[model samples]
Target: MSTLSTLKDRIGRYGVWSVGLRAEDPARRGQLAEAATELEQLGYGAVWLGGSSAARHAVPLLEATRTLTVGTSIQSIWDYDAETSAASFAEVDAAHPGRFLLGLGVSHAKLADQYRRPYSALVAYLDALDAAGVPADRRVLAALGPRTLELARDRAAGAVPYLVTAEHTAQARAILGPDPLLAPELKVILETDPSRARTLAREFLAMYLALPNYTNNFLRLGFTEDDLTNGGSDHLVDAVFAWGDETHIRDRINTFHEAGADHVALQVVTGGDRDTLPREEWRRLASLLG
Candidate 1:
């Protein structure tokens, strides 16, 4: 197990979350490494590979930076069995040691045909990880519910809850007590106009809106059916996304910190290409956060 005491110091107060970082093409490895290097220089504490990222996906990023921690925002249990996950963890850790975090998740029924009794399956997965000697403190859960949150507290390092509001972070902190990592991914739109920002947020949030895991969490956070419809209401969009001027964005991000998040993984939502890395936007955010 990792030294729980230093997890916060290792992860730091902020990270950059991006699906683009999980590029599988071998040709893009150099570019990805350069981006990782720049992110470390930019003062980001960590890099979370978005989507259903795996432990293998973290290797390149970890190799590209010395101090910056690299985590798979979630490596689905369905995609890799406990044995494979543990082996991958061992391989990566042997080279990078404490720089890798194995983020685990059950994914969704709609996305995985083998999905079954997610809670129970997640428990079993944890059990397997334990048997395979994967340290609890070196991992995290993509938890959104009470039971899973408790599981994160009891079985893993902490949680990396996605698509959640600040209030949920507060509740999760309460459940987590005064320890363990609480890093939630917050979507960001650099646009200042409400209409334009909401449009961009909606376009990106549309797919997640169709997932019950996220929608149910929204409902639990007091959002209504209408709020979940048509790519979410403006209120819902505004709550989950930081999309205004620099001052407003800073305040929005601070709310999560105030609510007890150890770190906030910022995911920039752009109007242009989704696959390409938003380096300019990242630079803007680095300056804004600084």
Candidate 2:
């Protein structure tokens, strides 16, 4: 079967990326499962399990939802080697088949004590998956800059870039050559009040701002050092996050689509809290996107 075909058109054009949807969370299993099923009923395309997820983490979600594509916003490469990762991937596929997609990434250097030669490590990892019979089409790389994006185009099914601007989506499409999937993770603040929304956004943005992988991408996308500093300039924050009411959110999603994103995984951020499931926001977004 073709790789994208396996992903299925059910992926539609939009989906949710959430850190709170972790399968490993001991307290939220039943809640998370019901939420995953609820998402499919809502007509949203996919649900990206964000924040250092493992392939094992995708299983319960897949078992909960029949057709919803549950992918890792990033399965941190630093945590799982290719062989072990591929084995876990196979386990999930055995139960759910094409209903799962693996989104692998070389996580931030500062976070991973063993981080080194990321591009080279990723290359070797992809090679291992290839040998393990993992289809390139069923996977995506969390690419940011040019070289990794190039690798994503050549080696994986496509790229799932996190915390990127619409312009970055356009640039990624140019590299991907019209066929590879371009699903950028877009942060959204559902509040209508600009000050409140920026306040909420900056809380989430502060941590990412410290990560060079993201800041460097901002630089590549024309953001200055000044823009990257001090909790991110308004221009930089505005570019990275979609804020202020439903109209603003829709416009931002459409901008990514217009710029070349085939699918956008909306990561909803409210008051910088990641523990609570944003079901209300997910429901609201479903109505707008549909």
Candidate 3:
């Protein structure tokens, strides 16, 4: 099997991305590990520590689970430099050979004070990673546009684009070609009421709307300026956050798979703190996806 195919086989196509995985307190870290172990036992392929996680954030999870591959959804280029990232990867790989994936990305300009010439910066980081002995097969780029996507294909194992539609997934797959892992973060709301779901979606999307990269991506996906105005249009919310029952969520994930995504990392959106583990929703989806 090709590198991506092998990694895909190991990681599985369904994974969970949760921002709460970074349990900094040494005391409660075991609880974090226990939660990850539960997911692995439940049969989800991998766990991606979301919210611009550092490489070390994945170590505890990898150390805890025997076979579950743990990765950073997008370790900020600004946060941990290539050398530190490589060092962290080395520590994890030494303990657990192939259970870690390094996810790299240039965060939003509004968020990162150092965000400048993202493409050039990403290339430089990848080059540094190469010099630091981090192989291309063990990393993924958080790409959203054509340039970054092409860079991801050339330099890394795959692209992990966030806040995107399945149509965007199809576009990215065509760009990355037949190889490279195409993993997209698919946010889902379990609410059945249309009004309630959209409200949650719009609220969740508000921050992203203020960010140019995401809004530009939406524009590229055929949404107008008005559609992006005031949170998001109903059409926009429906496309972005797959809401309603279990079948609806499954069908939406299938659309992404059909559109060429190798893995679909589900981010269960809810009113409560996303920093807390959404075990109930995850359990429900685990049953449904199975």
lDDT of each: 0.92, 0.86, 0.89
Clashing pairs in 1: none
TM-score of each: 0.98, 0.96, 0.98
Query: Where is the poorest 10-residue window by lDDT in model 1?
Result: 1-10
- Tens-place lDDT per residue, model 2, 1-290, is 55564454658888899988875766767888899999989988899988999777777778788889889989888898889988988888888878788999999998999999999999999999999989888899999989999999899889999999999999999998877889999988888887888788887888998888988888878889999777878898888888877777899889999999888999888774686788998888888776
Q: lDDT by residue for model 1 over 1-290, one digit each (tens)? A: 33776988877899999999999999999999999999999999999998899887887888889999999988999988999999999999999988999999999989999999999999999999999999999999999999999999999999999988999999999998778889999999999999999999999999999999999998999999999888889999999999999999999999999999999999999977667899999999999999
In model 2, how large is the Cα lDDT of residue 217? 82
- Candidate 2 matches the true fold with a TM-score of 0.96
For residues 117-140, what per-residue lDDT tens digits would candidate 3 score against the true structure?
988999999999999999999999
Error of 2 at 119 (Å): 0.4
Model 1 misplaced stretches (Cα beyond 4 Å): none
RMSD after CA superposition, every candidate: 1.2, 1.4, 1.0
Weakest ten-residue segment in model 2 by summed lDDT: 1-10
